[model samples]
Target chain A: MMTLDQDSIHKHSFNITNLEEIPGKKIKHHYGLVSGSVVRSRNIFADWAAGFKSIIGGELPMYTRLLNTTRNEAIQRMIAQAEFMGANAVTNIRFSTSDVAQGAAEIYVYGTAVFVE
Target chain B: MNGLVTAYLQNHELVVGSALLIVGYIVGTLFQRNHLRSIQEREAFFFKLPAVTMKLKSFVPESHWDQIESARMVVGSVVITPDYFRYFLSGIFDVLGGKVKSYESIVDRARREAILRMKESAPMADIIVNTRLQLDTMQPSIPNMPIRPLAVYAYGTAIRLKKSSFPQSSEEAIRFPDQDIIL
Candidate 1:
């Protein structure tokens, strides 16, 4: 079981933004760019539904909550990525989802890497 | 003559049976039509979220619009169709309803990716701002089935705020004269 804190892993970029290196600067700090991805399995829910089908059969409301929670988590991850970049601001953020298999769903989060000067 | 009339009546049974078959066929067709209509309604309600959310989000600020000190960007993806299909089949057992809750894994994966990216980028930044989020659909390449695979992508910038910007007044600076002011 991966805890929420465990999900908060970071990846660093070699490119550094030297906003603070300038002489007589009002603020000083090195800026970096970061990006990552989060993935979940579709089989977990499929199995659950299959079990239900074997017993009672019909659509399940449980999927709604599960999907909602996943969506929120994806957003949080994007925010976390921006936070890792050491940026005071993020822009042009976008989200997308894809079906990799019959039961699998993929959610993606991406944004520009920048240093706030 | 009476014996002949009895024979004719016995032979007419096939005709009566044929009429009953025709009537049953008509009733069955009507029931099937109604069932198809209900299925369409159910499908419409089931797949309505992505589009609705996308439209509503447009009116608000994107992830990039905010201003902050430190920020990071990440991308996460998850496949949800399998779970949906499972739920769809389970509709038979009454274990699930029209609401199939399987996309959480995808969203969770995406979030983890984004956070990891952000952490990597802004190890020391205090805060992030100007965040923007967007979503889109990803279709399958196969030509057979009309079922399109859906995908959601989210991206944003990371920022680190300078410490000096937090102070509201110069009084704090004056009180802490011993503090090494970088500005």
Candidate 2:
């Protein structure tokens, strides 16, 4: 049991899956809910540019790029935390975003960690 | 029409408001129309890309397939904001408390565009599973500021099934992706 516990803590490549099951793999264990979250804010320069963009606007690509990177970071962190528990894959993954402050926002990624064979 | 224009022009403040309204309406409507047209074109072009629900789970069950093959996550992102014209329309609409058509369509177009782009990333996948759309509303720090941009992101895991018995389609379906390039 000691050796098995240490082995589980060592880690493996983390996979993010939305489906409950990996197509052809057998699930060895279910590790319950795992999540990662991050809060981000833009600098003054970008905010100034975004302010100008709001006029005569169609798409604000800067904010899009910013939030995209933020969300990706959150997902990566979630997978990393799950992997420390010996989870090979995260299933039924979902994302949520909320206001942290005036300009700052937080993105949360959550899923069930499971060891799949 | 000419007399009404002259009447509005006679009042200095009214003339400025009228001019702004006229410019906003023309430019705003033009942008909205063009965007909708492009969205419609792409929707039809990517019609062959199959998108399913989380309820479907994986395309192939474990008993049906020997190997999992490839399962990759795909994303489609769109950031859309209201034009100056929509801002003007919204200001008036808010006081009257009616639906703001401009914003409604802007969000609609963004959502549809995001989904289509995600589907594009894995065109050959057997099925798109557990598709999730994340919409983030962005605003400037100042209170009651006009700038509000909505970021719509659609994502899903595209799984490739190795089954050889899947039916074949016409050559047209094969060639559609070439013409449907989002860039």
Candidate 3:
């Protein structure tokens, strides 16, 4: 078991999967659910670019990049929470995104933290 | 004089509207065609990688379970905005309250692209299982705008099968030093 403090750096590379079980491993302990979320506002410049792009119609790469970054950060935070609980793996991970306001969106990720071997 | 001014304004509006329609049609068609072609090419490239919406055990045999190396979550996301032309067509369809073929194509392309991106993320994985897709629409509260960005997110667990022989004992099994419990 890890005894590291909350502010300490994570020493282990935690595994994350969206499946019920982690392949090639056995779950030794379960620590219940851990989740993380973030709400981000759209950048003004990107919004303007998106407006122009919509006129021509196609993929909005700027918004895509922004959302991807937001989601990855949310997942990282979830992993951090799992690490804080001394868990080395998280299973059955799920993600969701919702628009909270006019230009802001929130991304939430959650999973079951577990110790595996 | 007032009548002449009104007539000129009407003609100007007509010219601008027609010009925008023409531009939107040509550019949107070209963009969609090119995107479709690229999507087809990438799909062919990733034809060997199997991504299923079922559990790995349900499909793979138990005999090969020992050969599994690792599994990790993979995700692919895309945000697409419909071109002016498609949006216009969909608006007309909405008035008719029927099938919006134009919007359907947008969702189809976004879903496929998201899946393709997910596969591209784990090129070396043996297979991806329990795949799921989430779709959302972002309509920024910009006043008087018909723009709605459709976001498609696809995620799954990519499992890699080992190539070497399986370990015979606990001592012989591969161990992750960082994951081991310290007494």
Candidate 4:
């Protein structure tokens, strides 16, 4: 399950903050914005079922699971990006979504990478 | 015999299509109502959680606020494809050039549910700061498909807050039906 060095980077070292600073850490190096993103769509069967469900109008659990998985995937890739950059923390983390095509969308995550002591 | 056969074929197609339309409408309505009810019940619990956004400059420091967090990012996202009835209604709205109100509530529910899930995943989060939501309305896979799914993502810095020294005593220790509401 763990992917070697990436696990170490993910476990405790990589702190995330939206504000300029964390509580009690001194930031050393600012490596600019690093990001991870992915685009995905449901399969033909799921789409067909979703279409049927749309008529009556309720929550599409299948689509919910799909989105949950895709968002996690994108965030993991973002963390991996920060790890590759030799950074210990990320601040000003942001998430954004946009349509790439019909039935397919992309989730993009970005944050400022920094080294902290 | 040929004319009879042709008439039968046309009739059969119409019967099947109409049956599906009616079925989709009836079932979709029930599902939508149940989903809304579920959201209302969940919201009564989730709203009590001390979740806020860092969008403005009014930044609440986790430590100063007595939050004891390990500095991690918590994320929650949801995708909702409209029911066939709403999809058809939206198509009509598109032609009429009006606001697609039918589709709005689903997105709102998805956004709230995503934040709820994020909070659930990170139970120790004092308050989810820098909270943001993204909505992506997918286009149809085919020229006129009924499956235009919209994905909503919610993410934030889920920091642990020292709950022992916070205000808002009225909103304390409200338990969720599914999970314990531990802030």
**Top lDDT prediction, candidate number:** 3
Q: What RMSD does each model have against the real structure?
A: 17.3, 8.2, 8.4, 5.8
Report, for every candidate in turn, its global Cα lDDT versus the true structure: 0.37, 0.70, 0.79, 0.65
What docking grade does candidate 1 earn? Answer: incorrect
Which candidate do you rate higher for DockQ, 1 or 3? 3
In model 4, which regions exceed 4 Å deviation? A1-10, A101-104, B1-17, B55-68, B95-100, B140-143, B163-183
| lDDT of each residue in B1-183, candidate 4, tens digit only | 999868877898777766666776788667767777876776675564556775323545444543353455666666666666666677789889978876776677678777776666555455666777777776656557645666666766666545533343333333323433333
Considering lDDT, which of the candidate structures 2 and 3 is the better prediction for this target? 3
Instruction: Give the number of the best model, judged by DockQ.
Output: 4
lDDT of 3 by residue, B61-119 (tens): 66677777767777888899988888888888888898998888889999999998777
In the range A22-81, model 4's lDDT, one tens digit per residue, is 665778999898888999976877777666666655556776767666766776787788
CAPRI level of candidate 4 = acceptable
DockQ of 2: 0.24
Highest TM-score: which candidate? 3
Q: Provide the interface RMSD of candidate 2 in angstroms, 1 decimal place.
A: 9.8
Poorly placed runs, candidate 3 (over 4 Å): A1-12, B1-14, B164-183
Candidate 1 lDDT over residue span B33-130, tens digit each? 45346545533532311212122124223442233333333322222232223323335445644533333333443333333333232333333333
Residue B41's lDDT in candidate 3: 87
Interface Cα RMSD per model, in Å? 14.6, 9.8, 8.2, 5.9
Candidate 2: clashing pairs of residues:
none
- Residue A15 in candidate 4 has what lDDT? 77
Error of 4 at B17 (Å): 4.6
